[model samples]
Every structure is written in C-alpha cells, then in structure tokens.
Target: MISRLSRELSPHLTYHSLYHTRDDVLPAAARLGRASGLNEDEYLALTTAALFHDTGFIDTYEDHEAGSIAIARAALPDFDYSPAQIDRIADLIAATRMPQRPADPLQELLCDADLDLLGRDDFMRLNRALLKEVRHYSHRPVPDDTWMRDQLRFIEEHRFFSPAARTLRAAGESHNRALMRAALASTNGANHAAGGLA
Candidate 1:
C-alpha cells in the first residue's frame, strides 16, 4: 500500500510524502498508542487511521481529509476490519483536520501525534521543510515574517490533548514558543528596516 502511495503521491506533497508517513507519523502514532494505554482494538484502529490519514493528498492537496476518509472506507474492509472499525478509523483521520476538534481519547491521541512536531526539538527544521512544501504547492513564497507570525499563532493556539504527549514534550514545546517569538521579532525588525529603505 505504501509502495503504491510512493509511486502515486505528488511531488508537490513534500510534507505529506511517504517519508513523513512511514518515518514520522506512523511511528509517533504507535508510540502514542502505547503511551495512552490503548487496548489492542484501539491501537489497531489508531495505526490504520494513521496510515490512511493524509492519503487524500494522493488525490488533492486541499481539504484532502475528506478524500482520505473516502479512501479509508474503500480500502479498510479488505484488511478484515469491520464497518464499525472502519468508521472509527475514519473518525480518527477526520479529527486530524485543522481546528482539530477531537471528540474522544482515540481522536485526541491521533490529533496530538499528527502535530507532535509542535513539541519537538527539531521543530524549526521540520517547519522549514513544511514551508518549502507550502511554497511548492501554493506556487508562491510566503514572506518570512508572515510565516513566522503564522507559526507563532499556531503554536500559541495549539495544545496537546493527550496526557502522554504533553508529559513527553511540553517543555520542548515551550522552548519552541520562545524560539518562534525571537525569530518573529528578528524578522519584524528586518522587515521594518527594509520598508524604511524602500
């Protein structure tokens, strides 16, 4: 399945590519499943949901979550997953969408895992990768100040709903918040200077 995704995924989908899914998102979901003490059924559900979460990007970049759910419904039954299980998996994937309103523990854990970069030391590095991806898909470069400001807003607004994620990475997230603030300040200063010269 992943081999299929690798062949079919768009070059424009840098952030949502096979590597991000295989290396980062999948591993994090497993870790969160363990940490959250999910039962076997829940763990399986979470893992399956994680696998199919961003697959909508395989079809389209915008509002791809709905497409992902569609793909999940079509494919999950082949794995012997029940309709109820497929529905649960689909719900978990859908909750990963922006605004991230998770209605239950499994959804919360999945949502936290999806955005775990928010609380990791490599956040800035990963963020640059995301920005490059955004530029590729959007066909325009977002200004540095605008990017930093938007990041600041997102990090400030984001909160890890899973106790495991918060316990493991809250301090790192705090450090990230400080780093973003400094980066934003520096970018604003530079932009101001540039504007004055213009």
Candidate 2:
C-alpha cells in the first residue's frame, strides 16, 4: 500500500517547490515507528500518513489537511480502514494546526515531524523560505512582525507531544524560543529606529 501510494504520487510530485526535501520524510517516519508503539499496520498507516500529509499543496494551500484527507481516503478505499483508523488519520492531520496541542502519540509524531526543522541549524533560512513560499503560493503579503507574532504564539502555546519527541527534540523548543525572542527584540528595535527617523 505504501509503495502504491508513493508510486502514484511520484510523477505528480516532481514539480512542487519542496520536492527536493522529500527524502527527509522517511527518517521521520522511521523515527515515529521506533519511538512510538506502532506495529506493522500502524507503521504502514504512519508511512501513508507521512506521504500524504502535505499533499494539500497540490490543490490549494488553504485547508490542505482536508485535501490530504480526501486524497488518502480515495487512494486507500480498498484498504478498508476502520472508522477509527480513518478518524485517527483525519484527527492527526488536523493536529497539524498552528497553535494547537497534539492529543496522542501518533498526532505528536505527525506534528513534530511536520515541523522537524525547527531545531535545525538552518532554521532561520528555512523559515524565511517558508515565509516566501506562503507569500508566493497564498498570494498574501506577510510582514516580519506578523510572522514573528504567529510563531511566538505557537511557541508559547505548544510543546512536543510524545516522550520520544520531547526527549529527542526538546532542544528545538529552546532554539525556537531564542529565535522568537531575538526576532521580537529586533522588531522593537526597528520600530524605535523608525520612530527616530520619523
């Protein structure tokens, strides 16, 4: 099933913007399986979950989770996943919502993997690029301050969900905190500088 899903998406996936970083996905999946108590079926579910999680980009950016759910449901109809499994996937996707806490281990793994780069050394550059992607794809102008505020709220309100995510990736929270604080300070300094210029 995982192979089939990957094969189906392969040709269509190449033209997307973040197509290059597709390999980073599997490691996250492997980590999820190792860290959580997922069995073979659950692991397959997670793999499918990881592959299609961001597929909403193919349609429209807004509510891509719903789009992903649609894609997953359509592709896996033969799998005959129970209502609980379907709901779990849907809820896991929804847990990717900004400023929301993940409710379980699976959701936590998804959330952490989705934002896995938060602790990376290149986070600032990556974040700026994401900002650019949003501005370009969504056709919405996002100022630095607004972006910082959104991140600040997220950092303040959220935490890693699973013990594995927390233990393995806890440093990311501090890194994000430091970056957020620096951004806030820089914004304030810019405002003061502009006041003097005015």
Candidate 3:
C-alpha cells in the first residue's frame, strides 16, 4: 500500500503524500493507540485506519475520505479482515473528515493521529506543505497573510479529542498558535508598509 501510494499519488500532493500517511500519521497512531490503552484488535483497527485514511487523495482530492473508505473496503477483505472490522475501520477513517466528529475513543484516537503534526514542533513545516498543496489544487498562489489567518483560525478552533492526544499535543498546539499569530501580524505589517509606500 505504501509503495502504491508513493507511485500513484499526485506529485503536487506535497503534504498528503505517502510520506505523510505512512511515515507521519502511522507512527502517531501507533503511539497514541498504545497511550490510549487500545487492546490488540483495536490497535490493529486504528493502525489500519491510519494507513488508509489519506489514500483517497490518490484518486481524488475532494471528499477523499470516501475514496479512502472505498479502498479499504476493497482491499481489507483479501487480508482476512472481518466485515465488522472493516466497518470499524471505515468509521475511524470517516471520523477524520473535516470538522472531525469522532464518535468514540478509537475514532478520537484516529482523528487525533491524523492531525498530530498540528501540535508538533514540525507544525510549520507540514503547514507549509499543506499550503503548497492547497495552492496547487486551487491553481493559484494563496497570499501569505490569508494562509496565516486561516491557519490561526483553524488552530484556535481545533481540539484534540483523545486524552492521550490532548496530553501529548495540546501544549505544542498552543505554541504553534502563538507562532501563527506572530507570523500573521508580521505579514500584515509588511503588507501595510508596502501599501503605504505605494
């Protein structure tokens, strides 16, 4: 699956690439699953969900969660995953959709793992990767101020659902929020200065 993703995902998907799912979210899910006391089966389900979550991006970017679910449904059966297990995996993947309404502990863990980078020190780096992806899909350059504002708003509104995620990432998220605010202020000031000179 990782190899397929690396081969097939669009070159423009800088942030949503195979690396993001396989390298970043996968590890985070494992860590959070252990921290959250998932049993062996639940841990398997969560890890499976994490790997398949962003895979929809390979086919389409809009409503990619649906694509991810479809891929899982098609693929998991061959791996001897039970229908019930597939359903749970589907639910976890769906929970990662925007506005991130996780219905249970496992869902919460998957959702948190999906956005774990948001609360890490590498937030800015991954944030820029996403910015680039957005610009690519939108077919235009997003203004720096606009990007910063959107990021700040998202960070402010976002919350980690699982206790483990909150304990691990909340402080880092706060730090990133402050960085976004400062960056936004500086960008606005620079823009204002440029306008004044004009």
Candidate 4:
C-alpha cells in the first residue's frame, strides 16, 4: 500500500501525499487510539482506516473517501478481514468526509486522527502545503487575504470529536488560531497598503 501510494499519488498532492498517511495520520491514529483505550480489534480497524483514508487521492481528488472505501473493500478480504470488519473499516473511512459527522466512537477517533495536524505545531507548514496543492488542482491562486480568512474560519469552526484529541490538541489549535488571525491581519494590512499605493 505504501509503495503503491508512493508511486501512484499525483505529484500535485503536496499535502495529501503518501507521506501524510504514513508520517502523520497513521501515527496519530495509534496515539489517539491508545489514549482512548481501544481494544485490539478496534485499534486494528482504526489504523487500517487511517492507512487507507487518503489513498483515494491516488486515483481521484474529489470525494476520495469513497475511493478509499472501494480500495479497502477490495483489499481487506485478501488479508482475511471478515465482512463485518471490512464494513466497520469502511464506515470509519467514510466518517472522515468533510463536515465530519462521526456517529460512533471509532469513527470519532478516525476523524480526529485525520485532522490531528490542526492542533499540532506544524499546522502552518502543512496548511501552506495544502494551499499549494489546492492552487495546483484549482489552477488559480488563492489570494492571501481570502485564504487566511477561510483558514481562520475553518479552525474556529472545527471541533475534535475524540476526548484524547480534545485534550491533546485543543490548546495547540487555539494557538494556531491566534497565529492565523495575526497572519490574516498582517495580510489585510499589506493588501490595504498596496491598494493605497495604487
């Protein structure tokens, strides 16, 4: 899976690359899973979901969760995953869809793990990468002011579903929010200055 992602994921995916799944989301799922007291089966399902969550990006960018689920459904049976287990894994992967409405505990854990970076110190670095990726796919530049405002709004609106994520990431999320606000103000000021000169 890792090799497939490394080879097949589009170069345009700076943020959603294989590195994101392997380096960020997978580890985060394990960390949060341990903290949340997941049983062995639950942990295995959650980790599997995390591993395949963004793999849809290998074939398609939009609505990739569906792609992920299809891949998981096809692949898990080969690994001896039971039908019910594959269904659970599929549900967990689907829970990560945007406007993330996780209806169960494992789903919550997977959702939180998918977005763990929002509360981490590296939020801006990854945020920038996402912006770049978006620009590449959208084929247009996102103005600094607009992008900053959108990011601030997203952070302000986002909530971690798992207790472990809330405990570990809430403060970091707040800090990142403040940083985003400051950056937005700075960007607005710069744009205003440029307009005044014009």
Tell me each candidate's RMSD, in Å, in order.
Answer: 1.3, 4.3, 0.8, 0.7
lDDT of each: 0.89, 0.68, 0.94, 0.94
Which sections of candidate 4 miss by over 4 Å? none
User: For each candidate, how many residue pairs have backbone atoms clashing (under 3 Å)?
Assistant: 0, 0, 0, 0
Better of 1 and 4 by TM-score: 4
Please report the TM-score between candidate 2 and the true structure: 0.77
Using TM-score as the measure, name the better of candidate 2 and candidate 4.
4
Query: What lDDT tens digits, residue by residue, belong to model 1 across residues 19-132?
Result: 777877888899999988889999999988888999888888899999999999998888899999999999999999999999999999889888888888889988888888
The numbered model that scores best in lDDT is 3
Model 3 lDDT on a 0 to 1 scale:
0.94
Q: Per-residue lDDT for 73-144 in model 4, tens only?
A: 999899999999999999999999998999999999999999999999999999999999998988888887
**What is the per-residue lDDT of model 3 for residues 1-198, given as tens digits with 9 covering 90 to 100?**
898898999999999998899889999999999998889999999999999999899899999999999999999999999999999999999999998889899999999999999899999999999999999899887998999998899999999999999999999999999999999999999999999999
Candidate 2 residue pairs in clash (backbone atoms < 3 Å): none
Q: What C-alpha lDDT, on a 0 to 100 scale, does residue 38 get in candidate 4? A: 91
**What number of backbone clashes does candidate 2 have, counting pairs of residues 3 or more apart or in separate chains?**
0
TM per candidate comes to 0.95, 0.77, 0.98, 0.98
